[model samples]
Each structure stands twice: as structure tokens, then as C-alpha cells.
Target: MKKMIAVMSGLAMIMTVSSTVYADFGFATEPDEVAAVVQAYIDEKLPGKAVIEISEAGEVIVKINKTSFLNPNQQVNILTENLRSYLLSNDADYSIVRVVYDEEATQPAEPTGPEEPAEPEEPAEPEEPAEPEEPTEPEKPAELVDPEKPEEPEKPTESTEPVEPENPAEPAKTIKPGDLDSSGTIDVTDLTEVSLALLGDRNLTDDQLKAADVDGDGTLSLADLAKLRQYLSKKIDSLD
Candidate 1:
């Protein structure tokens, strides 16, 4: 009788612990339709022990019971990245997401094993070649060039007053085809120069960088970089 009472007490405690730990979710999807997709994704990206519980949350299907088939002793950053990629690829519309992790009850779940770099996602079969983007129609810069190219200055004209070199007839806007950085125009020869300058393989004059940054977010992140290359490519091809 005493043993039975002890077992019942333990089961009651377990139920209370589970109820306190389980979190609610707001995401939605047809559970049966995407269950396989979600399961497959979990199996591949997470090789070790991790928990993935998929079920209906009220009207929506979800994996509210976040656990691991792999040991939960994994790097949080790596786990976050894997989760972000999974969410972004399959369901971009559902950006409003909440990831509730149990701090007290959770383990430092990191993959103890060596990690393989994620494989590149296969590109969707091209229905047609991608449409070419429109050119970057940038306004002409202010005239800073002199009318004529002066002979090289032999020495400083004045101790305090610096000599102003004569500018060419006009500022050259014609960029050669291989001028990737688009600073007044450097070519493959400028690759090293650029790399040395700001860690880019090609140098970018202030003007070129401004033109490349369409959103003006003051960042050369992947999106801005892609736009910059696209603009230069369009202009170069047009010249041909």
C-alpha cells in the first residue's frame, strides 16, 4: 500500500512538471500535408539527438513539444541558424515566430560530434532564364576635374598652399568591361588593390558604392552586393 502511494505521487509530480513546461504556439499549417516535409528536414539537418514533436495545436498543426532526438548539448547559435534556414526555405510567409526554450530544465544541447557544412540547396529548375534587371540610372557627379591635364608638379608650390593639379577635359564615366568594382574603373589588375583596401577583391570609389547601394542602408551585405554586380553587368553589356 505504501509503495502504491509513492508511485502515484511520482506520477502526479511528472504530470505537473510537463504541464508547467509545455509552451503554446501561433504558427499554422496543414499538419498531414507538411508533416513529412518537416520530419525529413529535421532528420537531415539535425544528425545527432534532438527533439521534434509535431501535432495539432488547437486548429493549427505544429511541433510545440520542442525536444531532441539528439542530446540537447548543442551550440545555441548553430541550433538557431538551422531553425532559421528551415523556416525561411519552406514557409517564408510565416515570419512571425516565437521560439520558447526552457532555460532551467533544458540541457546545454550541443552536437558533441564534428559538424559537416550544410550542403548547398539545389536551385529550382529554371523555367526560363532569369529576366535581366534594369540599369542603375545614377545621376552624374559634380565636376571636380580640371579642363586640362597639367604637367606633373615638380614640387610643392607653397609651403602652406598646396598646388591644384589641372583636371582632364572631362571626368571619364566610360567603365571598361572587366572593371568589377566600378570605381573610376579598375580591372582584374585592381583586384589585389581592392582586397588590400577594405577587404574587397576590387576597389569601390565612394560614388560607385553609393550607386550600388540601392536601399541606402549603408551596408554591403549580400543583397546590396548582388544589386551592385547586376547594375554593373547591365551597363557593361549595353556598352557592347
Candidate 2:
């Protein structure tokens, strides 16, 4: 009867410890009510060996503190599948339920030494500007002349004796009766001149008019032109 009492007492203690472990895990409750259901599921699979935490984005993180379960990786996968099925069955909004070992979660990052200081960069040299060219001086202006003191005029030389004026040219004398142009010949030119005079298209000189009056009436007319044409054609021997 004592053995039976101790066995029952021991079972009660195990139940109390399991309840304490589940309570100590403190599953997420404020941000998501579904977190309690997921925590309870993880507690049933891992018992007191796993902790449940919910991220701000409502992802379920199951950290296994003990690896005493056979095929821990397979167990994590099975637990993940079961939790995913439960969330799906309940139509919960949780998207991810990750299961990892405690060391993987709390492992310290490798220490990184300080980075070597970077070499100081040399400053670039400034370029010197080209020198400005000197300005050229302007040429001086010409001297101004005085208006009051004018220059003297040139002196005139002594005058010589007055020179005599040249005699006027002599008038041409009539060489012949038919030589009207004073060219020493009577030809078509004289005929043309006489014809132009008779037509009033030309003004003949005194010698030419005297010579052109072949009939000697002292006045030129068409009769003189006819007589002159007759003389030149040899029909009349004498122009007189």
C-alpha cells in the first residue's frame, strides 16, 4: 500500500513539474491569441525541453533546449509540420513556425578585430594661373599749331621783259574750184559735204562754200550739186 501511495505521489509531482515548465515558457499572448495554441502544441511534442517565443511579425520560434529526443532534426521537421497543420486547421494568421536548437539561437558571433586605418590621401596641387600680359602705351599725338603767329608767305621774284604775242594763223586759200575740203582733191567726200550743205544738214566754211558753188552764181543750190555730179561723172568736162 505504501508503494502504491508513493507511485501516485510521484505521478502527481511529474504533472506539477510539467505544468510549471509550460507556465514558465510564457507563450505569446498579448500580440496573438493563436500563440498559446502553438505553444501548447510545441509543449506536447517537446514537453519541457522546448521554449516558445513569438516574433513581432507573429512568427513562431521553437527553441529546443534538450536534444534527448531521437532524430532531433526529424523531430523538429515533424513538429513544424504538425504546428503548420494546426495553424491551417484553425485558419490562423501566423506565417512561419521555425524550430531550432538552443545553441543555434544563443551561439556567440565570432569576434572581428578592428579594421586597419585607411591611408591618408594626398591633397592635389593647385594649378598656377598664367601671368597677365602688359598693356602697350599709346602713341603721342602731333604738336598743335599756333593760330596767332602765322607762317610768312613766299617772296615774289623780279619780273622779266614782256614777251610778244604769237601771230594768228593764216586763212586757207582756195586751191581749186572742186577742192571744197582744202584736201587738194575733189572726190566723193567733197560731194558728200556739198550734198549735206544743200540739204541744210551741214554749215560749210567760206572757202568750202565758194568752192561748192560750181555754177558760180555765188549761192549754193541743187543746180550746183547737179553740175558737180555731172563734172565728176565726166559728162561735163568743165565745172565752170
Candidate 3:
């Protein structure tokens, strides 16, 4: 009975060691290959550093380095979902155990040599004073000219007829509301123009603005766009 108990104890010890060895050494496929694939996927999808580790139990551990500009939790969730789908699609049995942000170790700053002092600038020399100009001689007085006599005015001829004024120019044609393209009818083209205007991709003319303001609120807004779309889709009878 004592011998039997010792044998069972030895077998249990061997089994425990074997399990540990298998876990440490990895499973059937190389863990490095799995890690490489995971790293590649992370590099392609995200814009940060990541460390990938694999266990014998087919668990993929991902440590994502934290960044100041992004939300770590959100990034982890996104990566988790996408990577899981990607691995499953490729028939990979390995599953992501957990993805967490790791605080990266701060690198030590390099020691810098002492800076040299700047040299003092030399003082500028003073400018010399300008020389005085010589005095000019006085000019002689000119003689005065005599004024000319004025000519007599001519007499005007009398007319009996009166002149008529020219006709005024015609007024500009008014553009119909919602007819942005001025195609004589509102259609998809007009809708596209309104969409472009709303998106700030295209500048609308005064007439186009008036036409695009289907709601007549004096501004082209999403409400106007919705009304225009409804009119086009026949959800409503007219933009009016």
C-alpha cells in the first residue's frame, strides 16, 4: 500500500512538471508566428505601439501602449472586436484574452555638455556731422505783363421743338424658389446643388440661395434640405 501511494505521488509530480513545461515552451504551432501576426494586425489597424504574447492555452495577450490623445478603453474595445473577427475569419484558434493599456517606461534623458557663453558685441562708432551749404545770391525783380481785352459773346438761335426722353431698361427675370439650377423645373440636379451648398462644398449664388431656401426661413439649413428631399421623394406634394 505504501509503494502504491509513492508511485501515485511521483506520477502527479511528473504531470504537474509536464504541464508547466508545455505552458512555458508553447503548443503545437510556434508562438512567435502568432505574435508576429498579431503585431502586424495591430500595426495596420492602429497608430500606436503594442506588445503581443501567447500562452500554451491559445490565449493572445495584447498590451497596448497608452497615448495622450486617444481614449484607451475605446481603442481596446475596437481592437478586440476587429482582431477577434480577423483571427476567426483566418481560422485561427487563438483568442484574445485581454487588451489593456500599459504605461510605457519613460526613457532617461541624455546628459548634455555645458553651453559656451556668447561674446559681447562691439560699440558702433559715432557718425560725423554734415557740412553747412553755401549762401545763394539774390535774384532780380521781373516786369509785370498787361491784361488782354475780352471778346464779345455770340447770339443763340431760337428752337420751337421739345426733345423726348429715352425708354427705361426692362427688369431682371425672377428665379423660382427650389429651382436652384434654373432648369425651369425642380429636380435631382437642384437637390444636389442644395446639398453641396449645405455642405459648404459649393457657394450658392443669390438666386440659388433664394431657391434653395425651400422653407423660406431666409437661410439654407437641414430643415430646408429635408423639405426639398421630401418634395423630390413625393413624401410631400410641394416645397411650399
Clash totals in order? 17, 0, 0
Would you estimate the TM-scores of all the predictions?
A: 0.20, 0.29, 0.32
Deviation in Å, model 3, residue 195 alpha carbon: 0.5
Q: What is the C-alpha lDDT of each candidate?
A: 0.48, 0.74, 0.74
- The alpha-carbon deviation from the true structure for residue 102 of candidate 1, after best TM-score superposition, in angstroms, is 8.3
Candidate 2 runs further than 4 Å off: 1-172
Global fold similarity of model 2 (TM-score): 0.29
Cα miss at 165, model 1 (Å)?
A: 99
RMSD of each: 40.3, 29.9, 25.2
By TM-score, the best candidate is 3
Q: Which clashing pairs does model 2 show?
A: none
List the candidate 1 regions with Cα displacement exceeding 4 Å: 1-28, 33-35, 55-77, 92-240
Error of 3 at 122 (Å): 66
* Poorest stretch of ten by lDDT in candidate 1: 58-67
Q: How do the candidates rank by TM-score, highest first?
A: 3, 2, 1
> lDDT of candidate 2 vs native?
0.74
Q: Model 3, which residues run further than 4 Å from truth?
A: 1-164
